[model samples]
Target chain A: MTKVVLLGPQRHVPTVRSALDDLGVDGPVAVVTAGWEEREREVGELSEHLGCETRNLKLFSRSEKALDKDPELLDALRALNDRMRTLQEHYRLRLAHTMGAVRELVARRGAQEGALLEEEIEHALGAVHVLDQHHTRRTADALGTFDERYKPTERESIGRARGKVKRDLSPCAALLVAGGHVAVLATRLRLFVIDQLIEERPVVAWSAGAMAVTDQIVLFHDSPPQGRGFAEVLTDGMGLCPHLVALPHARHRLLLDDPSRVSVMARRFQPASCLALDERSRATWDGKRWTLGAGTRWLGPDGTLHEEAVPA
Target chain B: MSLAIHEFLANGTPTPEQIDAFLADRTIPIVEGPEVTFLYRGEAAEVSLQHWIYGLESSREFTRVEGTDLWWIVAEIPPKSRVEYKLGVIHADGRRELVRDALNDQLAHDPFGSNSVAAGEGYERPDWTLPDDDARPGTLEQRRIQSEALGQRREITVYLPARYRRSRRYPLLVVHDGPDYLVFSSLKTVLDNLIHRLEIPPMIVALTASNDRLHEYADDERHGRFIAEELVPAMEQRYPLVGRPDARCLMGASFGAVASLSTAWRHPGVFGRLLLQSGSFAFTDIGSSNPRGPLFEPVVRFMNAFREAPGKPAEKLFISCGTYESLIYENRSLVPRLQEAGMTVRYVEARDGHNWENWRDRLRAGLSWLFPGPLWMVYE
Candidate 1:
């Protein structure tokens, strides 16, 4: 069984380190800090926290290497990236309009609880949901086709890096993934096929790390300086951990008090719990149900927010 | 030069018996004066002082002591203030070295630092500001409101003064970059101390957190509308705040400062006082436009508008930028414009670079001038 536990962003305090120790995940650990991009190798503090040296899987550097070595692959990836951007921009424009309409109607002066308006919003939201899923699936399919055509694993640079990483992982007890840019992290993970490579190894991920481990990756920021506060489904994750949308720093970024926003998010991403993973909060999975840790909260579809029941 | 050497050094090749005496005399003293003295003991062909508070071009050539292996310099710093400085050493063959002060143990504490610190006698961190076991701290309550102007649900953290009464009306200060000012600048602590000492009037500070600080802080009229139309009215309804525009203030640092000033300018009579620190007021001699990212285009547009229009909205405006900041010339140019508009303006430049601490240090001056406490600036 792959025992995975997601924790909060470890800034000054190592929330993950303590979780690792409790779960008995001793080193030499394989650390995937590709999320941090260029600064992936700066693991001195991480190693100190874990009480062991970590073997780094510099997936970011290796990706750059592959791109540099193959012009064809780079061109393909760039074209795909450009297409994705165009699609995202288009989606954002429509989503902003829909969300804005919904918000205004809800806050309209003396506007009674109109089921018709609610239904209309639901329909609009349904369209948004379809578009989001379609985009995510479309991205996955595009990536899948490219992966099959290129057989990126067969490439010399990728092959060598994978082999080295796999070999390094042979002695490691578990994998520790740190967070950075979610898109970059997910791309690196998909490029390396981390889910396939470390199928049985116990893993611990946090922040965007945890987000990347989920089936669907959602990007959210409520009060962004320039745009409507609408959380968009970016793409698909590695599917290692499923059935939940991981929201790190939810307290900091999200307006949890707004019932309208919370209800929309919860209902929009149906079946999957909108799990908030703030600092000191943890969610462990032993290949089954989630064992909620202290400070963890989830937004219910009923428009109510629930906090994790800490054990006595 | 007759220099009163404050730093102690063990320069000579000491014998075993004299080693203890040498170690005993190595206590460096940072003398408090109008012109502070700095000492360093390092082997280098040439040494120059590179201070953090001073501009990049402020490389002072250090002179060697008459009979000892030490590089020393004394310069007139701001009478009562603390600043960070480093030594730039050059080898005989032309290799360069820039580092912290070796003799002085006092250093500025930062995540990315090693900059040596020097404090003047009258420039000590006030005792009341630091976290005290017995001090009555103000309460910070997080609140969220729907903002149609900005098309988002924004979070606002409000600081209520101790012994706050529902019956009593308080002055309102809307601080941009609310989180940074609260966390990094220790704004609440400063407010608590200032209020407790009656240095500044007891006020309610509403920290408006920005989502895309860069984009929104520029020339976005939506943000200004959000503050004036939505936020101010909301605050009025919720808190016992003085409804008059004169009792209201808008404050921020860097782009946050730009947004605050822009908002106050955009919404006339909404805010009386503007406290801007290290504002990123970029421009060239020719026009109010220059090279920056796409987001900064709005900044230029807003600046140009401000230049063309009359600046009669804000009654009292306080503009401060660091001497070490690249925006120094722009800030300097802005002061005259505000003054020409017949607006009461105060301009200050600190020795430190563009950072939060510089803004924090100037808060006392800004707030006191804007909202003076009982008997403040008034002789009985």
Candidate 2:
């Protein structure tokens, strides 16, 4: 039951506030974005209008030269990989140890005598294996595929990049926005944060946050004159939220200017349900039906309004 | 006073015996000019001096020579109440540099920026008794349900001064995060040490436990009320503690620090002195729905409010922090703000983290400042 609102690009502060008011959510919001002084002022203005909190959340980017200069990040990445390998080896050794212990107990005492002891050892080993696998998978998901192009060379650069990771991890929530293939990198970082939050506390997400939770991300913007706004190769998302693909700013001109094009894109890439959210719209799932909120409307492939009822 | 001139020539060396005699006398006469000349062992040495020396204290510069070799130069520094000087040396190669003294142990940092100094392994634990025995009468367990307003039962520990049994009244220091402060910082031991030394006046220490720490410390007024209405009055009634604002002080660390500061600022008449350590006054975004929302900027509003309410019954503040603490920068920034508002503040930076080591170090200095030494000590 993690609540998230993915605001569309250049959406007014009041519009976002309206969405939050409709949801009956409180304030003290953390704003995450990129850019320089001007953008920060804009963010401040937005925060003032919304009566919440905002901070710069963007860390690593394809633009930052430090990423190219720093070798510490690469070293950290290698270290993380080495640690993961060691953990796997240790897990195997533990399994071997538990099995050996069970064998010893069985040999010393007959099967009838050592049955309870053996069962307890098996349960412990099973729990350890489950935990080890979870950790291994999480580490792998966080690291993702390293980019050879952005690999750092200098120690300071590497340290700065490492610092960025620490800072990103330190915050309770983060929002990452990317326009190119870098989105994959952003998704990986988001997944790492999600995995971290799962182990400790709850975290909320929005557009990219929602996309990070999904299995795959469908780029719904057409290339000015193309048929539908779907990317050639569909990229996998962080998969934090399972079985759902989130389409934010559903009513924005860039994505919804041509309904037919969006419809075609939706048909080509069908999610569990097309969550088309407008500026003031919201949809929540309570492990049951998709409870649609105000400012949101759903549609079918036939271009007809689907059954719309006020979610109670 | 006649300026002694034995060797009155430039670039001449003096004998070791003559230099020793000059130092033994510990008296150097002033020679007025842009530069000064001094005589020793038939060799005249000229120094570009700005000050002169009188007795143990000095102001002007002087050079010395020992036998055939030139010993280190000595400056006649001006007399000041506090000893403060840095050696300016002109080397043989005509290059001038400040002489480095290994014994110059005074530590300070750039007033405008942040800096850190190293400290050795900190506080060690001593054998202390805990009030855990259930059979003991008039213990914390017996006085558990003192107030009905507090939803849950909690143990409050109050420490009266050594002369509390005979004294008619005593000042009080109400502290939050009672268990952690009392255990980790060894609050009782520290209090005992301060009182025994007579650094601070005889006062009672009230330790109040925080049940919901985060909720109470999140810059809320309701949490302030819980202390003012429930805890303060209850303690006053139980102990021979002073109820007036001037005699009462509030102390806390981390989130508790923020709570104490906020409480003191809101009701300065209720609590005069504030001891804030590693307080979280910076902006946070954890509990907000909108990432860039205003509710998360309560600290900004709080700062603005504090700025407007400059002077009051709260006459003194003792703010301290560890160099490595996360809120070091914030605390550093807060000092000037407090000072600018016409409040007497003592800021201390220790070489540790946001833990007991820093707080314990602060306790002695803080107590001495709050309650200065007696008139006899000042005269003596």
Candidate 3:
């Protein structure tokens, strides 16, 4: 049973120190900032903030170098990425129509249209849910196929990197993951099997880091440059917390004020509670249950943020 | 509303001490609703307001206080309008000179000089255009490429976004008159902020300059060939750019805008997006004498030719022009023509002049619409 702590973006306010104090575990911590990409090793500020000895695993560079040395495996991964992108595009197309119908029906909820409207709304919402599941499965299958064909863990360069990561993690009592490009962070984490190494250890992550530790990654934004902000399922995460849909920068990215959008999102994900992980938000998991911080909020089916954490 | 200025005026001519008290801790160009009053406290024979707002008097004499050295001019500037102006001071020595408002610190700079900026009511300089400590700055590398079409070595600055990697292929945006835009419009900072905010994707920006822009950027075939044939291909060979036309954008303002439009027109389906600002698209309704002068003859010719056929130059175009600019008519007229040609066009008009800041202000809307980043679309 791993003691997992999920945090919001560490910009204005940071709860990592308090979270660490509550965990009762101190000393050397393994830090994975693979999402930071080129700035992966720049942890001077983070080290000072933690007030503990921090060891950077440098997973980003290791994975990049490994992929560089193994072109065949790199090509295979790129192909998988391309396939995932196409699948996501297709998912978005289907999602748009279904979501439009849901919004239309939701807007007409008070009308005298009766069960037919409610039934249509449910059908539309179900279609969206089915689309999400289909996309998730397709993404899983794509990754599964690539893994089966390439056996990335067994690859010579990847194996070497993993062996080094294990040695680096041996002296650490806890693992801290910082947010950045979530895709890069997740891929690098998977490549070196850092998830497997920190099975029972205390882990604290924030933003994209929090999203990466969840069972599924759902990308959401209310207003983007391109068009409407549709929350689309990106892919599976490390499965550290299977019941959480971590939404970092939710206040900035999401239209929480609009009940229709919020309700649609809340009801779409169903069992997995859509957590609004703002800068002050924090949630701690002790295997059996979650103890949410005061600032932690979850999207409710009524289209508002609730103080209490919805039980997984 | 600046109450001090109003109080000072209400109490008749102010003494030196009173004027100093009014000036203390006051931001210049006192904006009160639709009325903007520009103040200059100095000893001059005459002070007049020199502004570039279209449909308004080009120069208006400022009223000098009888007992004080203060000179003030009030202009009815609409809400959310950004106006740039200078003070023309006629010294007692009989020499006249145009200078920026000494009392006002807010200034907008161009190639020639800087002018004091007077933002009307409900207007604020966008925070994203300014530099942020959190936004990672991109690296700019200068590369000189020999252009066979122009027969000159051109210096093109390439901007690689922060954390740019070889594994990822980025969209390309080719800009004309790059150096001027950097110095005047703060393009680098704008790119950094937009990318950091995820409004626009991390992209490879090709900043190209020309020696003879007046001639070269005036729909010259050689310049078009240089951009489409030489510069783009050279950039593609060196950097990992998405080869598709949609991913490639051509951008410019004024004559540079003309160059961008003509280049895309010459090489249809080569570049997908066009960001044209205050384009010098002078054209004639019928066969007549060119009233815009000899320099615009070539531009008028190009515009005429383009308007005739008006084939799809790019899939989408972001056209912006200042309402105060003389080229507003031409920019506005070109939009319908571009749309008629079956191209997706986004036309934006701002109460600005034909200067770099107006172009700068429109960058976020244009670039984001053209190449939106993963901030909203992609999770990474």
Candidate 4:
């Protein structure tokens, strides 16, 4: 079991400095900055803040090289992503109309009409549920097909990268993961399986880094261009955080004031607390228990939000 | 086709009921019209017709009918031109109010003021946004705050339920353009009615005023710092506001909206919610070069800088703009950027132009959605 701490944004204040101090592990740090995309190499400032000999796992570059070396793997992965995008687009349109109808119906309540409206609303809600299940399953199936066919684990380039990543981690005591484009970050982490490479060493991650380590990556935006606001699932996460879905910068991204929206989000991701990763918020999993930080909140199923703190 | 003007008042001095019916029937605008005649009911007090289409001084002086004390004004108007107007009544005492048609109930309000609205046959007033009489009203408590952030003193108005208790905590709504909302939109009344109907939760609203609003709201860094460090803290000491960052919201219109959004982005710890109405979020492809204008330079610079790296998202944001507003396209474009930042956003558009009235009308839906209450079960 590895010690992992999920953190808030580090763009301005670098809250990670205090979190690292709390971890108290003294050694060089390995980083996964793939989320930065092209700017992944700019870890100089990060190294200065961490005060450690930091090295990029370069998983982003390695993934690109691996895909280049294996044209068949590249085509298969490209096809999977394109197929996922098309399915996602279709699913989004259906969801927007359905959710709009459901919300409108839910708002109607008069003695005779209330009962009739509630029934129709529930029916509509059920349809959305069924649609969600279908989308999630189809997405997994599409990605699973590529993995099953390519067996990228057995690929020569990827295997070499994995070996090098493991060797690179040998001298490191912990891992530092920064935020960027979550899809890019999640892809590289999946390909390299750096979670396995680190193997019980402490890990510190923030923003999309925290989201990537969770059980599912949910893409949500209430006010988006061209359509109504509805949250959707992008893909599954690495399941490192456990029984918890981390929403980094939730203060900036969630309609926490609307109980209906809050409750729907909490229930949609049931069994896991929809934790809001506001500024200076952190969650440390110490093998057995979780130590939540100040300013953290979880969306409650009862249409309420409660702030969280580490158990005394 | 011209619809002939036909109205009846009692042969003697008209009864209040008779006057009401006559005025209601006659107040409707003439559509499919080359010309139109408006009827006003009064015995002898000089009545002047002030219209949105024609300014106050140019109001048509009413002519008394030969037989009855009825007053009539005639003017040439285009078809489908919906306009709001008021009567300039000099009751011999010179005491006057920009009164709604005493007999007509159709009214429209903005942050500036409200007026009696008459729509051409084809022009439909958005009746849905109007507040109902039976809905409960909220109370406003006024105070003056000395802000160190901007080094200026300003008035802050806090709104709470009519039966508010200090023991219970409520979510905080920090609204910009406070004075305008109080005079024009009747925001306190809207909150009261919404809460009474269970459309939205009984929350505390802090209406913050600005001295140099344009410069302060143009993505001002010092203004952003002041909100986070001073204004919010001072308000907490005075009210039983919800302390959770997520429970708080920053709302503004036009430039004020720009300030709210930029402040939230810069200091994510202070506020979590944003309600932007017709925000001037101007941005350019090349950094620091804004074709929008000198006034929009700061907002353009801020948006451009944000593009370098997306900041943390706020909780849920409710954004709206009038289709007729110049900033509609800009507001629409900001939607995708906010979503990409992983923000939950609610975008609404009204048919009217950018004015306090359109923004005021949207308060019901936007506020109710953002802060739904225990009474949220009722439908308007």
**By TM-score, who's the top model here?**
3
Q: Write the per-residue lDDT of candidate 2 for residues A1-312, one digit (tens) a residue.
A: 444443332333235555556456454444433222112223555566566554434443421445455455545556755764565456446544543443344345454656786565446445433544454455455344443433332246544554554554454333323221225334335423434433322233444444444555544433312122222212455554444546654553234545444443343334344556444555554333455666565544333334374232
lDDT per residue as tens, model 3, B52-114: 987888999999988889888878899988899999999999999999989898999998889
Where in model 2 is the C-alpha error above 4 Å? A1-312, B1-154, B283-301, B307-313, B373-380
TM-score of each predicted structure versus truth: 0.48, 0.34, 0.77, 0.49
lDDT of 2 at A270: 40
Please identify model 1 stretches exceeding 4 Å from their true place: A308-312, B1-380
Note the chain A TM-score of all models in turn: 0.93, 0.52, 0.96, 0.89
The C-alpha stretches of model 4 lying farther than 4 A from their native spots are: A109-130, A308-312, B1-380
Question: How accurately is candidate 1 docked according to DockQ?
Answer: 0.01
Select the stronger candidate by lDDT from 1 and 4.
1
DockQ of each model vs. true complex: 0.01, 0.00, 0.27, 0.02
CAPRI-wise, candidate 4 is incorrect
lDDT of 2 by residue, B1-380 (tens): 23344332243554566555554553222122211222222223333322111233333455454444332333332221112233445556666644322223332222122222222223222222222221112212123534444455657777765535533567778788766776767676666655543346567777876766765675677667667777788778877776888678888887788788877776667887878777766643233233324533565456445655645536788889766555787788878778887778998876456555457557766766665522111000
The CAPRI class of candidate 3 is acceptable
Task: For candidate 3, give the lDDT of residue B215.
Answer: 96
Error of 2 at B122 (Å): 11
For candidate 1, write residues A107-221 as lDDT tens digits: 6525766777777777877777787777787777877888888887788867777787788778888888888768788888988888887867888998889888888888886
| Count of clashes in candidate 4 | 15
Every candidate's CA RMSD: 24.1, 29.1, 5.8, 18.2
